[model samples]
Target: MYRLYYAPGAASLVVHWLLIEMGQPHALQRVDMDARQQKSAEYLALNPNGTVPTLIADGRPLYEAAALVLYLADRHAEAGLAPAVGDPQRGEYCQWLLNLANTVQSPMRLWWYPQDLHGLPEDAVREAARRRVEAAWERLDAHLAARGPYLLGERVSAVDFYLVMLMRWTRKMPRPGDAWPHLGALAGRMKARPSFAALYEREGLSEWR
Candidate 1:
């Protein structure tokens, strides 16, 4: 069984939701981020970065939510969350996944913790990050409007899970991701999945429900 170390409604939400959706056998160890448990020496050993969503797979520690998403989808190819390696859509899959990770998710970190900039004006940093995130949402919404019901066309993929998790993060933002029509439709479909309810219950999340 996989052992997942997570913080409720954090980046770990995607990993937890995937586990539930894929019907993977897993156990959870909720890292109390409010109490700084993720930074403790014990947790640090499992993930030097001291982040939640540290997963134990085959007795080896794994971190990074995107990498974990890719890993799980790859290992369980029958779940069909990822395009097959030789498929033409594979490149696009990796592209959007990396885009979500690099462009969207990274800026969101600044939006949530602008204090990470240290010496800079937190407000300026946050506004810049917010703009970057909104640009990403605009681009994605257009992509969906033109070519989607799902990011990968007709079928749901692992990236949809990643996307919805990020969308939920924006629920409290000045302009939420779901404010975009196509994005709102996508989020509705994803949230309707049975796994999401379990994810919310386990993570104790009520917002954006």
Candidate 2:
């Protein structure tokens, strides 16, 4: 069984949701962010970065929500959340996944935590980050429009779940992900999943719901 250290509504939500969706029996270890527990030396040992999520997989520790989710997708291939190695859409899957990790999620992080960037005024930093984040969503909105229904065409993929998680992060933004109609529809579909419902319940998230 996997042991997941998480903070509700944080990036860890993606990994937590994946475990539920995949029917994986996992233990939940709460990292109290309100008390700054993640920065403690003990927590650092598990995840040096002191992040909300540190997945203990078969005695090994893993971090990074996207990576953890991707790992779970690959581990539980029967879930069909990821395309097989030789599948043509596998390339597309990797591209979209990595792109979000780099471009989309990156800016959103800076937007949320401007202090991480330092020096610049917080407003200026968020203003710039906001445009980039919204543009990234605009690109995705078009992609989803063209693809229709899901990120990988007809069926769902882990990437769609990942996208939904990110979209929720943008809920308080000037133009949230759902502001883009296609993305809004996509979010609607994903939120309907029992796994997502469980995530909301566990995380005590109400706004994005």
Candidate 3:
């Protein structure tokens, strides 16, 4: 069994969702971000970065949300959330996952906590981050329009789960991700899954549902 250290609605949400999706046996330890429990020495021992989602798998601790998603998908290969290693679509799978991590998810930190970009005006940081995120939404929407109901086209995979989670983050943005027609449709399709309902219930998340 795995032990997942998480904070409700944080980046850890994706990891927790994946565990639930894959029907993996796991337990959760909620890190109180508001109380700075994640920064406590004890939590730091498991994750130096003090991030939510320090997953204990096979008696070893692992972190990084995207990595956990990929790892879990690979571990539960029978679930078919990822393309097989030699499948033609495998390259695209890796590409979109990394793109989401690098292009979209990285800038999200600035949008949420602009002060972290020290020495820059918070407003300026937020504005730039917002544009970057919106541009990603536009690009993804076009891709969906041209070739998808899912990111990889015909099949739903781990990437869709990851994208849906990120899309939910944009729900309150000035120009939300779902404001794009194709993106809105994709969001609707993903959120309709029973696993999503289970995820929201488990995380105690009511918004963007």
Find the candidate with the highest TM-score and give its number: 1
- Angstrom error of the Cα, residue 202, model 1: value is 1.6
Q: What is the C-alpha lDDT profile of model 2 across 32-110, one tens digit per residue? A: 9989999999999999998878999999999998888789999999999999899999999989899898878999998
Among these predictions, the greatest lDDT belongs to 1
Residue pairs in collision within model 3? none
In model 2, how large is the Cα lDDT of residue 136? Answer: 91
* TM, every model: 0.99, 0.98, 0.98
Error of 1 at 96 (Å): 0.7
lDDT scores of the candidates, listed in order: 0.94, 0.90, 0.90
Candidate 1: residue 126 lDDT (0-100)? 92
Name the weakest run of 10 consecutive residues (lDDT summed) in model 1.
199-208
Error of 1 at 90 (Å): 0.5
- Residues 1-209, candidate 1: write the lDDT tens digits: 99999988999999999999999999999999989999999999999998888999999999999999999999999999999999999999999899999989999999999999999999999999999999999999999999999999998999999999999888888999999999999999999999999999988888889
Give the range of the ten consecutive residues with the poorest summed lDDT in model 3.
164-173
Q: Tell me how far the alpha carbon of residue 65 in candidate 2 is from the true structure, in angstroms, after superposition.
A: 1.1
How many clashing pairs does model 2 include? 0
Tell me the deviation in Å of residue 58 in model 2.
Answer: 0.3
